[model samples]
Target: MATDDEDKVLLAVCDVIKGSTLLKAGRSGKPHFRQFKLSNDLSRLMWESAKKMDAAVLISQITEIKTGQVTPVFLKNPIPQCEAVSFSLLYSDRSLDIVCKDKKEFDTWTTALKALIVDKYDNKEAVSAKLVEMRGSIVSEDRLEVQLGTIKTKVLLKDNSCDLYLWGGGDRGRLGHKDDKPRFLPNVVESLLGQNVTMIACGGSHTIALNSKGQVFSWGAGPQGCLGHGNLRDRYSPLMIDGPLRDVNVVHVACYENHSAVISEDGNLYTWGKAGPFLGYMDDSVTKQTKPRLVDALYGTRIVQVACGRSHTLVIDEEGRVYSFGINKFGELGQGHDKAITKPTMVPNLVSICKVSCGRHHSAAIDEDGVLFMWGWGARGQLGQGEPKSLFSPTPVNGFNDQPLEDVSCGYGHTAAITANGVAYCWGDNASSQCGVPSSVYGELSSPRGIVLPSGIRPTQINCGANFTVLVTSIGQLFTWGCNMSGQLGNGEAKKTFSQPMPVESLSEKRVKMVACGEDHIGCLVGHGWVPDEEVKSCMACKKSFTAIRRRHHCRQCGGIFCGSCSTKRYPLLDKGHADPVRVCDKCYVSLSSSSNIK
Candidate 1:
């Protein structure tokens, strides 16, 4: 039931001490019982249904818990005091009303759930204090009070903020530095030193950043007005998008190719740039937008997340319903038919979807039950269907039904996912090793393959570039592999490709919070600050003198360097210190394929 993502510490309670069966109260009141279970990581509560009605909700999604006496479920079908017990799990827009067998069962469920709010969060400190004895009535609106007792302790968690960094191809200012210069290693976006950037998104060449104040900033190539500045000019530094978005409080942002979209705290969606029909415009006259405009067609529904593909856009609301729009020539919109929809339209069949991702032409989604569903382009096997056929509608991607996944990512033509146990599975186009597997061994990965990462550190987040992939671990370190022709790998070298995840040694001291990748550039939001490793003199491995021809190389195995060679030919006696992959070499030859023993 727990996701293998170790950094989150979600599975504080691993074992299901109580039975999985629970009675769920329905609005219509017919089938009042269902099989219920909790994911191992304590991230979600799932309803195990044999049919298509299976549903789930993240434990973090639950806003509050209320005792049965105060909920409307008891008023609709009042249960006598001698009959049973009930408690309602309230969300932002709905409530999950359930009935328990007895007070013991009620106490067990309530205590375990309350523990999540306190223990699951990172950097938490529990404080014990006595509750004020109340003989009188309490506000029932947002209260959780069981007959057994009131709360005795509370946990206060620290909030961490990340500073922004950028590197790789700096063409047209895509890297956001004041000067358009290709940074081979991690470089701080000095202008945004105090921006407190919470999220970032990358397009074909431009980039977008979201700060804690909910304001939006963008920079890079603005041709077709992709920068949202009301002009088609490129910028060499981060520029805040004001105008129409000045007063809007954006909570999330997504961009791809030549377009961008942002969702406000109120669940309203806004879009800009050359998105065509995917902008949620009702008419064909709206070819592109220079400034942010609200998608009026989706006025009533609350959109929580948005993803943009090459030819389509995907979104999911608070109700777990999926929607698609834009060009559907390759069925990238997830619509049953291969026709483009000019506005927001719900994708038929998918329900309780918690997350979604988009590649150049394909798309991926995860439902509440931790089930993966894919659609759109599959010609290169990005859909993980074990075939190259395109799926016009949403279809379940079978593999991790038992150990549910908490997150997934889509590269230009490849896909990757992380399981409940923190293991990474990848598939799709591998011509450039974008799938994290050896391209020579498997030119095309149709089915998902679990990749082995360095022991100890588990993957917390992952992202895909056009021909590369980057992963962030719980301890704030980063690993990048695949095409580095434009230095997108951030390993201090260009024109190299690696199948195994290699550490970006330059930023080892920075706790990487998130990574954003464009077709050629890369951006990272890291917690706090760090300095690059000190410059080395003689090669630590060979203890050789300074010379131009004997170019120094760092070993990937030992942080000494990114071992210049992904080979096992055995060089001169090795060096142990961190440097550019000198003769000591990269010890990190771990492969994504489980059966391989190549060093």
Candidate 2:
């Protein structure tokens, strides 16, 4: 994966603008070390760049940093009014600019900005060493402790008196619980006690995690060996995936279908999963593996980000080139045809993809400008294409052509996105109300449409399940709608699905930072105000479904009338009042009964 010399390097470098000296440097090619430093004033650079480009003045201001606190520094002069002003930042470059009204404003901000600079420089040595160590390790688990995605895993940390929240499905622990007994609430995993965990991911059934120490651990299903454990056994607990990948620190990890990918501090990519061409699984005969292996094909490419679909994988190189591989059954891989690739193939016509998400059958990418592009399955409107016909290549979603999309996520048959201003929109099949908006359209939409939430609530993140939707707000509130079967919606009922978003009462007062959805179960990561009790929330419908219970541990799955904790106290299913009652798992309950539909 050697790129031409012209390819620009990308790395996440914190750019600090303070007083006289604005310094920027990050892990370059070698071991973690400060390789580049810039001493010029950011304000002067901004004005010069704007003037040279024939652009109007656009004042740029940032709060001053004093004693590790951010303080606003107001300018005596007003900001320049211009037709357009743009701001851009690259991971490695750290160069910045602002074209604004006058020198007075710049000077005033500069004075305030100076104090922050001195503070940053004073702290640079310690932070730099930490950054280098991060850049050197192959899988930096510490950075992942508190990640967010569609499905979230929460393990309580008694030491910190807080719960560790992780999102994204990297393993079968899709419920986001440390274990898999159909957890409905975020609880302490016990196994992860004492150690501070920040993030977790599930791919297919496999799970990967990062700790406060910057280490990565993985477990669960290893189909195609996505667990990176170097074995195919279903790990009931978390285990470290591998050692330092190279002289790099892993900053992010993404899981799709059965493949896993990670981004390092220096913007390098390392992946392990299906043995395909682009995935670098050299064992031509072995399609899957049980351990994490380096993707030699991507060496030196400086990958900034990655994503996975059900059977395909995506990598965004620093130079904005997208590489794709794996199954292209529906042309979801974006490789120009339904040709399955064994190696990494450059995705056609995709550049500056700031974010990417893959559904069960399709894929979506958001560019740097916030315009969303979708491809793959259009059936049930998962692609938002306004038609049932599937797409073989990337197509721009029309409704947001003018407005920039802040983020986008896809489900089995739907898609949702948030705009830059915080408006959430959805399109495609509303069956089970997964779309969050009412759409009689049975299939997909060619344009994006808005999804209404309870008024005055703007969601910061969203996740989609088989036929349901979950939203978490900046204020730590949780809302859900759509298919409520099995109490997945956590409303203490087995009612029909909703066509619009509704708050989940059981999780009220629980500041939910993340949410994860399984095919039927759901899990959320709580922040502040969540009750720690494990009281059973009964689903009256489930109660009626139960006919008998032969074993202990709640029989919600078996339609048993007793809660798990109460199952042992009952005389099984022998009661005369329950004569001829039937027993089955919770999943079977959906098949045995029908209830009145609630709007």
Question: TM-scores, in order shown?
Answer: 0.64, 0.59
For model 2, how does the per-residue alpha-carbon lDDT over 1-599 read when each residue is reduced to its tens digit?
Answer: 42431111111111222111111111221111011122222232232121245312211333322221111111112111210111222222232322211122233333333433332223344335544655544231221122123322221122212244333232355433445554433343433432235555545465565543345666666556777767666676666666545234467777755677777766766777766654655347666755556666777677777776777777788777778877788888886688788677788999888888777878888888887888887876667665666888898886754778877777777788888777787776676767765445433444567777676887888777666778888787877777776556766566677777778765576567666554465545554222232342442223423235522233322322333433322211111111122343343333222110100
**lDDT value, candidate 2, whole model:** 0.53
For candidate 1, give the lDDT of residue 156: 14
* Best TM-score among the predictions, by candidate number: 1
Off by over 4 Å in 2: 1-162, 165-179, 193-196, 243-248, 274-285, 437-447, 492-495, 516-525, 528-599
1-599 per-residue lDDT for model 1 (tens digits): 43434322322232222233455656654223344566544577787554557588888888887766455655675543312356778886787876553344455566566666534542222110101122131112221111212312111111334678899988889888866778889877755654568999998889999977687889998886788988889988898899988877799999988689999977899888885887787776655699998899887789999998776789999999988889888888888788989888998888999999988988899987778988888888889999878989888887654678778888888888887778778888999887888899988788888877988978878888887888888787998888888888888877768898999997876678898888888898887532223555554434564456655554322323222232332221111111111132422222111111111
| Shift in Å, residue 356, candidate 2 | 0.9
Under the 3 Å rule for N, CA and C atoms, how many clashes does model 1 have? 27
Off by over 4 Å in 1: 1-160, 530-599
| Cα misplacement distance, residue 257 of candidate 1 (Å) | 0.6
